[model samples]
Target: MLKIEGLSKTFGKGTLNEKKIFSNFNFNVDNGDFITIIGSNGAGKSSLFNAIFGTFLPDEGRIYLDNKDITYVPSHVRAKDIGYLFQDPRVGTAPNMTIEENLFLAAGEGGWFSIGQKKKSNEFKEKLSLLNMNLENNLKKPVGLLSGGQRQALTLLMATYSKPKLLLLDEHTAALDPETAKKVLDLTNKVVKEEHLTCLMITHSMESALSHGNRIIMMNDGQIIYDAKGKEKEEQTVQGLLNLFKTKEGNLMASDRMLLEV
Candidate 1:
């Protein structure tokens, strides 16, 4: 459903600290595809998401969603069709707002007039109950008062409330504890499948990359070193992926965080 052609981006151009992120990059994401992306530091994984979501205009290339070019679309405009979840749970939510208020905004009903409406409140409670986090009874509690996992779960629900065409998850569970992360990931899978949404997730865990998505892509130096799906992806193992990276890049991945976390 998304196509990126001849994409390129660079930062600090023409200066001593210049860095080139992408050069003539091309990628295509099929509809309903859940793609897991893994790469070392400076591999442009998050940059790819930023480019697609219009966080910054690419120096060159065209980005198309559903056959319509959106290369120059402003980030705010793209926000209507794209849902992005950051690693930090605090990034997308209003800390001081009550849980109900936040959901009220995400649901896009109207304004404060729509906040306590019985019908809308009931719907929000029903959705919250599905989270099984006892959040339905905490509607009046400030989001900042919730635990990290709880806040992240709430953010996930808010992002998907309107069903965007694509969801971008940038190491969304990287900040949580193991058990909490698992819970969040399980909820993520459930939501994506039930909504039939296309998704791209950047993760540090090799096991997560292999197990969670239908397709797995390994990137390095701003290029896709490996792309596998279906039977090929299912057959890949963590050790095999490490060997492939060593063969292609002449060494194991250089990121300490990636190595340690996986």
Candidate 2:
């Protein structure tokens, strides 16, 4: 239930350093659609999320969520409708805040601690218990003390704590070890399925994009160049997709590990 029409952005306008990030970008996300965005560095994958999440207002274009124009909506206001998790797990949780406390303050659902003792601890414990990862017992633990995977999984829970309409994951598993990343990715998939959350996930690893999401989109020069889903994506190898880019859009040089990581 999101749409982007004629979206474009550029930096350093009217100067020798001018760089245009995207041009006439367009895409529509369906209810519960899990879209994996894959592209190399400087490809505008993260920029697109920032643009959508209100971190950066594009020089031009319109962003709509459920048909309401949110082009100028401040990031804080948009937080109620959209959730973003950065590549760094630390970005999602407050290290100094206890697990229950962090969830308590998420999206401003509870009263201020001084207003009245918020009674969310029990409800939050029940929710965390569903993770089957012992996070329920660590409700009072500082998020910074968690392992990378745990923090990422907890961040997943935090992003959805308020049930935002859409979730934006920007290379959320990149920093973890392969095993930890897989665990976090699995947690992400489970949560999305359980909640029926519509999501946009940016990733460099083609394997991840193909393995986890229902759809995969290939982007270049700040525009979507290839879009496929489900069985359509299943038949192709990662190398096949890379070659397709070569044939259709010319060679795009990205890291070898990035190609292999997914």
Candidate 3:
């Protein structure tokens, strides 16, 4: 469960380039809710995640997770309860490290130190096996040698190994080919359901937003312009969502990436 109230963020404040991103933005996410977020470029989708992840302090307002305030909590402190997968696969992994080594570090989150002796545990192997990518046999292989999809899958596994309270997916599959993206998305869905994790995913594809999550949110000009859930979300088609965006914002959806994905 996450709640944000009166959240405001601005960059280059009081200068010629002063541009406000969020103006009293407010949102609430329920426990175990899988929410897909969509918007054109500069809709503040990534900024919203950055604020929640404590990448920087917001100018005002508060954030709470499971009823505990974490607005000003440092990113390292929040890392234990939050799992983040970046759009770039390389960003989330240590390229020089072996696959098992990376996973060992992930599993040891919130710990002061990790014992190298435990890297070969059956638990680790079992988890790797679930990927169905034959990564279990390549534990000693460097992560840099993996394909894009394989590395992303490993990152997903590492991120969820501890079953954090929330998972933040920032276009995690956008870098892959269509088929590979679908595989990764399927794996993501499987893991999220198995863990019953609360998730917030930012995606450019209208089809992805409508197809994956139980809830869909549209952002425009730094505010949530539309939010749909349950039957409303289930009944939505890509064309209908595009029409809704046009109706709400009185402008055509203008992202080439989003348009092409649909």
Which model scores highest in TM-score?
1
Candidate 2 Cα misplacement greater than 4 A, ranges: 107-109, 112-119, 252-257
* Residue clash pairs of candidate 3: none
Q: Candidates 2 and 3: which is better by TM-score?
A: 3
What's model 3's overall lDDT? 0.89
lDDT of candidates 1 onward, in order: 0.91, 0.83, 0.89
User: What TM-score goes with each of the models?
Assistant: 0.97, 0.92, 0.94
Candidate 1 vs candidate 3, lDDT winner:
1
C-alpha lDDT (0 to 100) for residue 45 of candidate 2: 88
TM-score of 3: 0.94
Across 1-262, the per-residue lDDT of candidate 1 in tens digits comes to 9999999988899999899999999999999999999988878899999999998889999999999999999999999899999999888889999999999888876775754578888899999999988999999999999999999999999999999999999999999999999999999999999999999999989888888879999988899999999999999998888888888878774563473365
Worst lDDT 10-window in candidate 2? 109-118
Give residue 42's lDDT in candidate 3 (0 to 100). Answer: 89
Ordered by lDDT, highest first, the candidates read: 1, 3, 2
Q: What is the lDDT of residue 85 in candidate 2?
A: 91
Whose lDDT is higher: candidate 2's or candidate 3's? 3
